[model samples]
Target: MTPDHEVLVIGAGFSGIGAALGLRRAGIDDFVILEERDDVGGSWYANTYPGVAVDISAFSYSFAAEPFASWSRVFPPGEELKAYADHCIDAYALRPHLRFNSRVKRASYSESAHVWTVVLGDGTALTARFVICATGWLTKPKTPAIAGLDTFKGDLVHTAQWDRSLDLDGKRVGVIGTGASAVQIVPEIAERTERLHVYQRTPTWLLPKPDFAVPESVRRLFRRVPATQRTIRLLTDVVTELSFVIAMVHYRRFPFLAKAGEAASKLYLRRQVKGDRTLMRKLTPSYRVGCKRPSLSKGYWRTFTRDHVELVTEPIEEITPSGIRTADGEEQDLDVLILATGFHVLDNLPPFPMRGQGGRDLKEFWKTERFQTYEGTSIKGYPNLWFIVGPYSFTGGSWFGMIDYQVTHALRVIGEARRRRATEAVVRPEKHDRSFRRNLRRMRNTVFLDPSCRGTHSYYLDEHGDAPAVRPASTYEAAWRARHFDLDDYSYER
Candidate 1:
């Protein structure tokens, strides 16, 4: 039996959008983009908390092929990103092909038919010759396992699912988790709230984000001469490569680089606190700079210095109806509670169920055998399946870089399969094993392996004591290998 479509892209996020564009550019269009949300933009669309913005520079965060020259700030806000996603969908005419509110329930592969049957939440099943899982790592928000959390009578919200209608003005608010989201949210709400208590389980490495409005002349220059924007992107990529990618990827060979980064961060924090050694110490991270994802902020540090804002370092005992009780038995009454506890990384990489090849479950395989993937895209037993953001797929850089490279890699294999009139394409077991081993070997030199990362509970490292979230290579390498990797690594069958 023939499949319903040639391909089925399982998200409408940047990754899925990239896959759709890749298929279109390869002169193939018989595909659909499935989204659980009511609209496009994925995380950017879902996350609209106050002061939300791209953590990285605006230029690097965007696609190279379609440069957005009219960003209002150096680190563009969440709304701009939402607008950008819409712009891409409109520009590529990807609307008709998108099925929003279509949540994938499970996907099963048929060995005999060499096709994938994707079951949606509403019980509708669609078949496709190939399936690309682009439901990214941030799809699932994680709520803390604090006791009595549900009993809290105050309005509660996760940073991922913010309700704009909920009011915080002149109300006592408690924010949990000092991860990326809290770094942005704390400053925005500190001044507005009657009293703000930032509960910090772990202090994240804070870097100075030089954020400012883009002058009209600069935007005009970028629009008039596209090369200028490209040049800025190039510079930003290089700086990111030097500062972050290199320090983490080659931490063993260049231990000082990570140390230097940490020292610089400490200095920045000290200066921000105006030599208030007590406040500086409270905000200092115990782990290496690159262990957990560090956050960039201009006001995150200053917000803590505000008289109305108090940083709570005590362990949270439980949530009372009035507020949160700490280990010391101190309870702070709150009118609102915000869980900025971040997302489930490895546990929700695919964000759904998948069965491939002779009733083999993908989640069970990973649970028993550890998370592994061929070039962070394909698995051996999962035929005709590609992950735009799979285990070990994210090389340290702007997410757009990872998306573009992975898209190119998947499209190349799909293009080759079509050229051969093949019914299925799967990575050879040996090639897949070799790639997995190579990743493990290279990861030994990275910061994740450093002793300081122990008990850090970084989302980067999975349960298997392996950092499967990172590709352990520079973005340039990822880009190059994506375009030039051996096609023979995959076994195409007619």
Candidate 2:
């Protein structure tokens, strides 16, 4: 790939590839995508743990622009989803523009030259007129700090970086952190392992996942009539958006619906646990269901029914060479250990050093107060730089929906910059503050910031104990804001 391009997309995942195509469609061809890994699928390629699948329906998970009517399941597995990412690259001919194994080290913009100088991990330099930070939110894995963790002699693994080559058959395995990954992985490994232990820090509300195979007849209809697929996706999109109300925004107002969801979750847990009251008590969550990101799974609950599987609720004190030790001084022997602890999404700082106007470091700017971005894409003093999945941009729908908004908005800004021959288009600080303040107002009364959740562990809350990950608004409003590019809100420097 060329070291210089008019546009530089900093990832080759769904968001990065989508941004590249979005730029291509805007008739801006001089661009390239830099992927840290050799493969294209960012999260999909990285997360290959057993039973890993999309929580959102496959129809909704897919890009509205690119429709693949032949999804195998309601929630496509990691392998299938990664293949879709592969399909997008091939269909859009983006492979030629991809630079694999190129991890970004830092980015510094020159106001006089009006160009961003991107420095690679190996000290390679590249210049681009515009930058799309599509580096995904959940890319950095977070492992817990357990005493004696390094002394563990048994096989160790992480869900994010699963070693598929390891054989777990007849092995005594212990899985840590009962979050999204643990739920999915436990079910897959239980039957294979001679004995399984699930360490739970905080229980999650697992609603029944509506998963089913696509019948041949339905597939034929989707293929014969492509619009039918669009119609189905549209309907699913509406259903997903409504969840923002029933589950996210106004759930407290509609307490019955929330209660209904919690009721369903309790019933599922009870039914699976049967007469095991102790297990049922351990599985039930005390905090509000919406406080944590709700998980969906039909298999996870039933997996505990296996006599060989045990759910350990005692807090882990340390990791022994033989196994994990609990606060009660009980140590379980394990032949293998897997850490399902999630990513460091709320690190509150850019992964790499970023310098903006007048050589101001982005990290230093946020350190004194907090991390902030305008419209979750543009930052004050950072001209011609955009983040597709930036802070406070997630709109409680499929990530495809969020990326669609941010990418289109970014390209529009670039188009405007080119049209005016403007050297830099930097967002005004007031505008950035205004948008951040709006999100702050929306944060009130949300389940994440609910006073009852003071002790709960959630990645949604940032370092300052504030929930600013998602914009509290409807999908329609988010789309309108995304498309309504206000040139007046930015300062154009020539």
Candidate 3:
């Protein structure tokens, strides 16, 4: 027999978990969390790559439902994050309503019934009044499409979908793309690999992480005095939020901050890499500081100091049978190849065939690269469907804060729906959506969206040369907006 629920949340990641918990808190327990994987922790479960850790601080990267006073490191590792998600599940008693190993294959809205008919991969059909697409942006792995890639004799892997069985000890390795994953993995591999060749499309601004372990005494003190930890977390969030003002307001006008960042990067380069000034120049980024995500790592810079590691900044023409070949007729052989190229972030929602009102597909409607919602949650045509960390909500600070805020907004919407006795509600107003996109385009002209950036093809920018993912200013502002979900912003139908 097919099961029925009031709300069905797809993918039991952080977002899905938040949605389920939020619904429960609002006295809506008839919702089920369907997870493709048997376990929770969406991205953290999939990515077990070496040196995989959160770039954001531990305090802000955690859930508001359950705060952790005993984080082992300043920047917690993947395992710790996964454990935290598990802890939330256990603490909230959310397992009873969760359906594991049930991947949603199709979701079609029935106009006659005013309900969503969702089909699982195993042919099980379920009905729900509302559907929450909590499948996160970074869950999918995007491997670069290179010629002769399949012909490679050695093992190939992506940082997101890492193969833990493969050994890198004493083996020649080739790493493609110097993005966030590359910055984290290269240092760990450099220690084990015989010869490591890093192919950089463009150099990124490497910032000092200042990552360190929290002492046992400090953890005990935090546990004893909760106010102290909260104060520290708030201070950190404020400082990080204020830093985005330069990128939002004076990107083009303010070259001083970018210059200072560059000068600092140069100093770090000089300190890390010796005996080769040309190599340092190649490693230096030509773009502004906030143009792309500035990577933070202690060992990323120090890894280049190793004798066996070589950083190659040549345009890759194609992949040969043995290894990768450059445009300048240079070819390098390797035993293993790792692609650290990021995910399909522009395509926030995948090709899952989502049909909104009037049989209009959401993907087709958003074809012009103007994927705007009222508050990054509800689309104009999509009724009763909410996106947790949707478009324009990509505040460069800690994502956890934003997720919490969105979850709260979603709960409020659900509460409103129940109170009004409405079957469904679409929280996007046409004017608000248009105005938000217009403001986003105007803001893109600033420093963060510099046209002359070394690598213009960033996750921050969409296909239409506009940065739709980044938030307007800071994390606090984002949280405030999310927490105060304006009913006026949404066009509700009872």
Candidate 4:
């Protein structure tokens, strides 16, 4: 039996778009991109809160193939990223193959037919010869289970699902979770809100964001000569890889890099807070740098110094009808409650039921055996299935670089399978295990294992105490391996 589509891509984000482009390059046309929302730009579409922008430099954050020439700032805002996504879709004519508002419920592999049956939320089932999961790491929003949260009468909003119509000009607002989203949102709303109460569980390491408007002349120059932009992109990529990526991945070899990062962060924070020891003590994180992902912002630190803005370090006990009650018995009244809580990283690896050969559930397998993937794309039993973002997949650089290399890896396997006229392609169990072991060994050298990171509650470390979210190798190594990995590692069957 033949499948309905040759490939079923599980998202329309940058990852899925990259996969689509990869498919086009490989001359494979029978594919469909299933996006859950009624639009493209996965995270960028969902997050539209105040001060939303890319933390990384725009030059490095975007795709290398389709360089964006008209960025307003060094760190472009969310809408610009969304526009770039739109540009890619239009340029590649990917809209025809995209199915919006199509949420996948589950996927099951068939041994006899060598195909996958992917069921939608409404029970619409579609069969595909291959399935590529590009449902990104930050898809599902994490909401805390605080007591009396449901009973709160005020307007409650999560940063991931911001209400654009709601007015916050003079409202008393309480924001929780000082993650990346909060770091951006708090500063934007602080001056506007009547009384902005920022509840902090733990402080984050912050670096000074070098954000500035890109001149029209520079944009024109970039447009006129693409080499200039490429040069900047290359420089940014190299600097980020050396300064941040190498420090995290090769922590054992260069522990001083992380130390220097911590020193720089502290110095920047001190300068921002202007020697306010009380505020500084409350804002400083106890964990090692890179234990939790650090953020970049010019205004996040100084937001706490405002007279109207209060940084509540007391643990939250429960939510009252009118306000939040802290453990210290202080009740802060507010008209708006914002959850800046981050996304579900490890728990929602797939965010849906997935069954492989012999009815092996993917989540169950990971829960029991720890999250394992061969080169962060293919699994041992899950034939013809690949993940653009999988365990140990992210290389701590730009999202586009991750998408590019992972797409290259997945498409290479799929392309070879097509060339061989094979119906199934699964990584050998031994090969998958070897990769997993390699990840485990390399992860020990990282800062995640340091004693200082013990109680930080970092999203990078999984339940198994492994930092599977980050690829232990550099981006260059990842790209090289994606292109040169042995094809024989995957067993292809007709």
TM-score of 4: 0.99
Q: List the residue pairs that clash in candidate 3.
A: 251-447
lDDT of 4 by residue, 1-494 (tens): 98999999999988899899888888889999999999999999999999999999999998899899999999999999999999999998899999998999999999999999999999899999999999998899999989999999999999999999989999999999999999999999988999999999999999999999999999999999999999999999998897778988898899999999999999999999999999999999998899998999988999888999999999999999999999999999999999999889899978899999999999999999998899988899999999999898998988899899998988888889988999999999999999999999998888889888777889888877888889998899999999999999999999
Supply every candidate's count of residue pairs whose N, Cα or C atoms clash at under 3 angstroms.
0, 0, 1, 1
Tens digit of per-residue lDDT, candidate 3, span 423-477:
7677556655675765576575566556665355677767766666776656666
lDDT of 2 by residue, 235-263 (tens): 88887776544467655556666677789
Model 1 misses residue 82 by how many Å? 0.6
Compared to the true structure, candidate 2 yields what TM-score? Answer: 0.96
lDDT of each: 0.91, 0.84, 0.78, 0.93
The C-alpha stretches of model 1 lying farther than 4 A from their native spots are: none
Question: What residue runs in model 4 are displaced by over 4 Å at the alpha carbon?
Answer: none
Ranking by lDDT: 4, 1, 2, 3
418-483: candidate 1 lDDT, tens digit per residue = 999999999999999999999999999999998889898898898789999899999999999999
Model 3 Cα RMSD, Å? 2.3
